[model samples]
Target: MSDEATGQDPAVEDRFETGPIRPPSEAGSYLLRLTRGCPWNRCRFCRTYKRRKFSLRTVEEIEADIDAMARIRDRLAPAGVAGGPRAAVRRGVVTNDYEWMVANALASGGRTAFLQDADSLVMKPDQVRRVLAHFRERFPEVERITTYARSRTVARLSVDDLRSYGEHGLNRIHIGMETGHDPLLELIKKGATAELHVKAGRKVKEAGLELSEYVIPGLGGREMSEGHALDSARVLNAIDPDFIRLRTLTLGPKIPLWEAFHGPEAVLTRQDDAEIAAEIRRFIEALEGIHSRVVSDHIMNLLGDVEGCLPDGKADLLARCDAFLDLPEGDRRLYQVARRAGLVNGPADLSDPGVRARAEAVLAEVVRTYGPGRIEEACRDMMLRFV
Candidate 1:
């Protein structure tokens, strides 16, 4: 662990899950990479950040990154404050979470910081605190900090340590909850169970820091898709985090799932993404009480763009899914084309007849070029994401 204050490397540093979080007030938010990759990278259905190894970055390294961001924040500071720049800086300094911290830091002449690697929290609490303090002391303007944490790490930690970090302005955490089904988790070699996921989520909530949970559709596959939906719902229902981000399963090279599919005689035939849509529909329908905002921001998900207030927009969301299902098979293929092109994902609108026709046209070419068997090939490629 390199102490930023002393310019010495700590024995270890922070790591991050390979993703970013966007806040509504994202103008000031910073993406702190706290974890390197998924510690349990063996999941059959996952590919995001799986190619990387897990590591803890040094405190100095993380602080240095923050210091680099401080310059930008400093320049923007004068604009956001209502009163004079001094007042702006003062208010910005007190915000405990990262966005506020960075924004405030910019206003206050402090730097905003984002943690790196995978599990930053894996560092000793005192070490993390020192890093935060050094940032605080040196920047005096950085008011907030954030990092990613695994359920297992959160569960293993004593709450006081967490509370201390929060007090130090280590403000937000993102948890990857791909699916909550225990059997599915087992299939994927996810390190934590549904219970641990909740325990970690609630602990973050209890600590008074912001939390975002990620869920990936189709990880359970058609065989266990229903269980994936219901069981994942069960897990989220317990935590009810600030956000439940959507990440649909997409394939890449070297993912273990592809190996499984090819190995022991490829038992699972690829679903036409209609199954992916169905899985999303089921997931939305199953969600219950708790004010959680669902987000489908990634291109890999069939409903990658579909998300809204849960259980309330649930009806409309499902209706959208039904509409997609109603399209002619050719039109459905169009939507799939759009999905691959990153033009469309999610249960959102693909109503433009032209877009659908275009999708169909594209699918025709794809089929002509690669054959229908290519879907399986694509799925296999997606599964290789971990390697």
Candidate 2:
């Protein structure tokens, strides 16, 4: 169909793309796809970019996308100023995916942007600098620009290069340091060691960029939970990142980690909610000499409320974990069911009678269907839904 016939702008529509996922905190930010897939897609616990080949978009291509997004902003700005972007969309004024992306970002104040897909820093340093400069020129309102990068990729770049990126427009880098335990890193094929993670994280800090290191609470399974927690804490202590985000592990049959749970030679045992909470407690306790904020922002995290600043909030974070652990067996199970079902945030929610009653009802139904012994399995099934 002709563009005139369909009322579509091919320049804007065909020039840009978005990736599959972004951090939960970036729910409102504009997404700019700099790469097509993960540079290292071999992590067994991750299925995000599997089967897709990684490729970098050129400076010209990314600039084209920035231009398209700016066009979208210009088209939607009047409607947004009159009422709002959402109202415009409801009234059929905002048309096309590109317009929606711009509208969403505008509605959220248009202060942030995230570069995708996996390792954006893998692009040439000069190219990244040019892209960031062009992006700032297009969207000067964006105050924070962030991207996902592998620790190994960050390690490959000199501190000067990262600092230059920061000087351009980039503000933060999020690294998936799933586990700092050597055996678990190898088991999951994370493609980097603990030492490399520390090196990369330190370099990022030295370059004056905010860093968020993600740690999977159950990446080591039951057998190596202690080592996972302790070693991860050791690594974080060395790096002292700006943010320590907890993303609990959730495995399904499609990912290679599933093989560790099934078949004759199975070597790993999945930890239940209680076991994971204990491991998290141990991990939090092991965190020392770092001022990073512990964030439980993801829905997959069972203790979604286990977040606080370090040093001062350290005791409180432990108490929050203990709050869940100290609940009666039945109450703990009820809270687990409620959390997995999205009915409640954490054990603290159960203090309210209404929330407690609702959680009890959910627990009863889960017990009736999955049987009391399999409540953990039911919770695992629920967690898989988020994955």
Candidate 3:
């Protein structure tokens, strides 16, 4: 953490030699930035970690990290030497560790190391496999390796190579399909076509690995709400991934899209609760074939479990949408208030007096602070987290 220990710029806050690191998300598991900032961070919707350059951790550097971990693990063997804990030993591992002991303890625990930055697979297939092999040698117990792969990147990997990775224990790949709408895709400069997304997704399927594709319901906003859903549905209908993650958009400041939205030539867009709901509906309505669960599990999503198997659950999902739309304006606002305040997930029974009162209180305060401005601002911020 000190300057002497890390020759990195004082301005650079968090740097890693290897192992793993990530940004938080509702999706399960931690991210190991394989590349750093996104390969194409110019997308207006994202600003979370785009303030840096993209680079790779050299093979030698990664290997040295593995060695350091191995050495650290050996240094912390039990003090009694002949395979036994001390009679007085209790609680967690002892605090007093020799230099070697510290290394040994660290190495012993280094079983699951995620490749860093964004697209670690950007490296040659053979190189990636060798890295996987090295990981197996240094930390053999690691069974669930993963990476954040760009669809374009995954599309480039031949089926044989992708399958080989699956065999080698790289069990999952996360791709941000964002929205399946080509117009929307172009608006945000996603750098890949909708057809390309389908190809990449199918390749993941062909590779025999779990694929989690993110869908941003509100990316099109009211301007293209129906198109957002219909096109996205068509795309997902084609790919039929194992999981379709519902990422309700949350726009934040520092995102370029915000500026574009307010600019004279604003092609930027966002969806409100009702418009977003309709967008989701159209998306679902367009679905057929390719069994994918419609998930709204993320907190940002209005309906928490609007998720289930396709075909069989399609009508039920539609009925839920009808139920929501039919609610009186006050009732609809009630659900929105409850959702944004985290009082409840989805449109649940606000009939409970205590829950209703709490939601009302939060809404009241929100109204007081930003007045009507809050709604637009909140929508903008939500847009930033799109897919």
TM-score of 2: 0.95
Candidate 3 lDDT, 289-382, residue by residue in tens: 8787777767678777587778789998887776677789877776776776667665655778898899888667756776845654543443
Task: Point out where model 2 deviates above 4 Å.
Answer: 1-15, 81-86
TM-scores for the candidates: 0.73, 0.95, 0.78
Candidate that would win on lDDT = 2
Tens-digit lDDT track for model 1 on 1-387? 111122222122122122333332232445444445656556566555566775666666666655544544554454564443335445543222222334433543333445654466777787788777766665665566666667888888877888888888777777778889998777777788999898999998888887888887767667788899889988898988888887766544356675544567554434557787788778778788877888876655565556677667778777777777777875565566666655555424466676666666666777777787575444334333422
Which residue segments of model 1 deviate by more than 4 Å?
Answer: 1-54, 68-113, 136-145, 265-270, 345-349, 353-361, 371-387
How would you order the candidates by lDDT, starting with the best? 2, 3, 1
The digit string of per-residue lDDT tens for model 2 on 1-387 reads 112122445463544788988898897788998989998899998888898988989999888888888887777777662354556556776655566667777878889999999999999999999999999998999999999999999999999999999999899999999888999999889999999999999999999999999999988888999999999999999999999999999888898888876678678888888899999999999999999999999999999999999979999999999999999988888889999989888787988999888888988998899998998999999888988
Ten contiguous residues with the weakest lDDT in model 2: 1-10
Candidate closer to the true structure by TM-score (higher is better), 1 or 2: 2
* TM-score-based ranking: 2, 3, 1
lDDT of 3: 0.65
